[model samples]
Target: MEEFTQQAGPFTDAQQWWIEKIADATAATETDFAPKLLEGFPFSARGGTFGFLHDFGREAAINLLDELRRALA
Candidate 1:
């Protein structure tokens, strides 16, 4: 399972884009979501097929979406 669980962040990257769109549409800028996204990491290290940061970003995106859903609900 771990072998198949390659680190991936493109999904997270795209997710953040949508979130930004929503924020723009609503004129909202929540610091919570405003983490130096690509901070502390190189561009090449972000959307790889395997890495701890990638996995972390994926999980973070999931949680962020969930929060958005609940808030909107």
Candidate 2:
């Protein structure tokens, strides 16, 4: 994920600090039935695949935060 961090460019600034939020979300959401999904989020890919994986996590973070943000807002 660190590798992706470096390449996330414009998004890097937006998401760089979101890592903790993402992680917390992952932990909370995965604490029950979805635990496996968050535990072994494999990142073993290359090139385009890596990019997708990178974006996957970021998008996932955003997706998970959607409801949280809305509720808070």
Candidate 3:
């Protein structure tokens, strides 16, 4: 996702922390947290869902991810 890549370097460091918070919070409120959110994603949007990520709307990020997947495929 363009927005995701721009917001977080990788889901490696601070970005990982950012998304972990959302996962943590979601888990506290819902039992089906990670699975529900991660079911069909490209595995790169996690960082953005947390505070570690910034500025990416869903469409831009999905589009970017789709393009990247297409290229890789």
Please list the C-alpha lDDT of all candidates, in the order they appear.
0.41, 0.41, 0.42
Q: Given candidate 1, what's the lDDT at residue 13?
A: 52
Tell me the lDDT of model 2 at 67: 38
Provide TM-scores for the models: 0.30, 0.26, 0.31
**Clashing residue pairs, candidate 3?**
none
Which scores greater on TM-score, model 2 or model 3?
3
Clashes of each: 2, 0, 0
Superposed by TM-score, candidate 2 places the C-alpha of residue 52 at a distance from the truth, in angstroms, of 20
Question: TM-score of predicted model 3?
Answer: 0.31
Model 3 regions lying over 4 Å from their true place: 1-10, 31-73
Q: Higher TM-score: candidate 1 or 2?
A: 1
Residue 58 in candidate 2, Cα distance off native in Å = 13
lDDT of 3 by residue, 1-72 (tens): 335445544545654453444345454555433323443343344433432224334664455344434432
Runs in model 2 lying further than 4 Å from the true structure: 10-14, 31-73
Q: Flag clash pairs in model 1.
A: 7-49, 7-50
lDDT of 1: 0.41
Put down candidate 1 lDDT per residue, 19-73, tens digits, no spaces.
Answer: 4443443334443333344333332244422332354457765665456444433
- Name the lDDT value of residue 37 in candidate 1: 40
